[model samples]
Target: MTDKATAAGELTDIGNKRYFGEGLLRWYRKERRDLPWRRSRNPYHIWVSEIMLQQTRVDTVIPYFNRFVGRFPTLRHLAEAPEDDVLKHWEGLGYYSRARNLQAAAREVVEHYGGEVPRGKAEVSGLKGVGPYTTGAILSIAYDQPEPAVDGNVMRVLSRYFCLEDDIARPATRVAMESLAQSLIPEGQAADFNQALMELGAMVCTPKSPSCPVCPVGEHCEGRLQGRERELPVKTKAKKARPVFRLAALIEGTGAYAGKVLVRQRPETGLLAQMWELPHIEAPDEEIWNRLDEGAGLLEAALAEDGVRVKASNEVVGEAQHIFTHLVWKIKVLGAAALEERYVADRTGYRWIGPEEFENYAWPNVFRKLLTEYFLLVRRG
Candidate 1:
């Protein structure tokens, strides 16, 4: 390989690094998107915005960020609120675990750090769910610490700029990218430089069809010069999501609980843990699932196993689909009625909530859609 080709893999050239950093930051000051999170320097606000922005787009996160910060306002407010309330605000955003972890970390901050976000790297990283990217982002952006946040955006920009052909999905690539990114942060310009790199990737050097003609640092980008901008940041594809067939019961209330519906709390661990949902069971095959009567029977039997009994109707109320990172749930909602009112006495993991009480429980998006449809049906009748 020629010397220039070999040099593309390393950031040993100091002049190039200075030029790239300075050019990107200059463009950022003139063109940075007017985001709500960028308006504040409070570590708490920045921390919340960074967590929400993970796996979510800028436009989608804007309203959620506004409402969340408006509601919580401070670490103490989030720590004091019920987990259900916090999850409700975070509903429809997906990745519900982030919301739960944020609250857990908030409570820790309040109790341990006197309600102030810790500035030290060790203390910040120790907070639950605050990983390397978040640690660097919070430290550098909020506290002006010269920490490098090497998330996918930063990695992509760096990988393409230096023509580094490392698989970003690998841990080793991230460690090396963090070192290279840290080196590019000009003295006392870590905040602007890091944000500028991320913004450049997000706005200019996008994953597909990057607009290189207008990129501020296009003059020195090795990937662009070598015609490999689209392929430099190679990533291993993720495994396919496993499908799960579920029979959900929209069990109607009877007797004293009339005008309400039966909902159950998920186990305290695993996916959607502690969230409320209509009773559901894992169906074995489509043969049984296609048979509405059998599906209702299976749902009733499953609820009975949990010490609750209901007479499910053969009519199917609705169906919904939800996708998680590793699991895809194809849910069929079946209508049902309370068989006997006596089962209400043992309401350990279950409860009959009136329509108005729905807001009190945090229903996962799938259940939320199903329940919304069911309520609309009731109102139409």
Candidate 2:
């Protein structure tokens, strides 16, 4: 373990630590946003909010959070709910794995900890999807354990205050920041101090054009003094998302399946797992994409591989785009009608869902948008 003297070497002179810590906490008490999660110190609520808040903005998460908690209400409630229903609530939130892990962890908590969120570091860290940052946030915020929660916000604030130029995207830099953050927490003030750091970063020490003048510890901020606030928390650029073209089959149902559309469940594992979507086939390249008839043939062939036969029409119904972290999908919707009224015996994964039944199954935002547009088009006709 590195000594505090070495870990916080250059940052040692940034005013008295007590002044910065206390002043920030005082400011937080007066200015902290009254978010739904802050209303209680329940570990479960904090855990849920923290998970949802990852890679998502505060304002955007508010309604989702309210709805999620309203539906689940408690850890047990979440654990008991169907995974599909849970995904339904989290449909548009993205980073869907977070929801899955949250439910898995909730079940773990119920079975292993008597339905209570564990307070100890080791126990909490063992929970699925609970990383160091989340572990610290729950322990400090809910249990008042004086642990450090070093997320991007805390790292940015600390980097600017201490003028540390380490790349926050690196693992070593995060470890160092965690240490520095842990040292700054005053005894028994972990909740307020941690929250204050995050609040300052969000509202004042933002990524761009930080409000340096209004910062409580502005005078002591080394990055501000050096005029390098914007450059301190350096992060490497992420790789560009690769584009993928796909042909989505808007299969129209007939006979017993009339007034319904054909949808299939994604495999139980991997990207967008367990969500329902329109049957789609990846177009080989720009050549395949340029020819709708050829693309329709490929879509039909792909569906046959899955044991469902259909004849795709050349007409394009609509188009949509969805971007994941590493991939971008440019989709072209094509009309199709089932060649046979009944699918093969093992067609359980595929279903004919009516417009009104759309609410029962969780569709990724891209598919949901496509289906909505298709339904509106039908209604107009």
On lDDT, the leading prediction is 2
lDDT computed for candidate 1: 0.88
lDDT scores of the candidates, listed in order: 0.88, 0.90
Which portions of model 1 show Cα errors greater than 4 Å? 1-12, 285-287
The sequence of per-residue lDDT tens digits that candidate 1 reaches over residues 1-381 is 888877874545878988998899899999999999898789998999999999999999999999999999999999999887898899879888899999999999999999999999999999999999999999999988999998998999999999999999999999999999998899998888888988998999999889999999999999999999988699999999988888888778767877788888998888898898988888898778888888888888877877787888878778888899988998888878777656653578788887788777888889888888777777787
In model 2, the runs with Cα more than 4 Å from the true position are 1-14, 344-346
Candidate 1, poorest ten consecutive residues by summed lDDT = 337-346
- TM-scores for the candidates: 0.92, 0.94
Q: What TM-score, to 2 decimals, does candidate 1 have?
A: 0.92
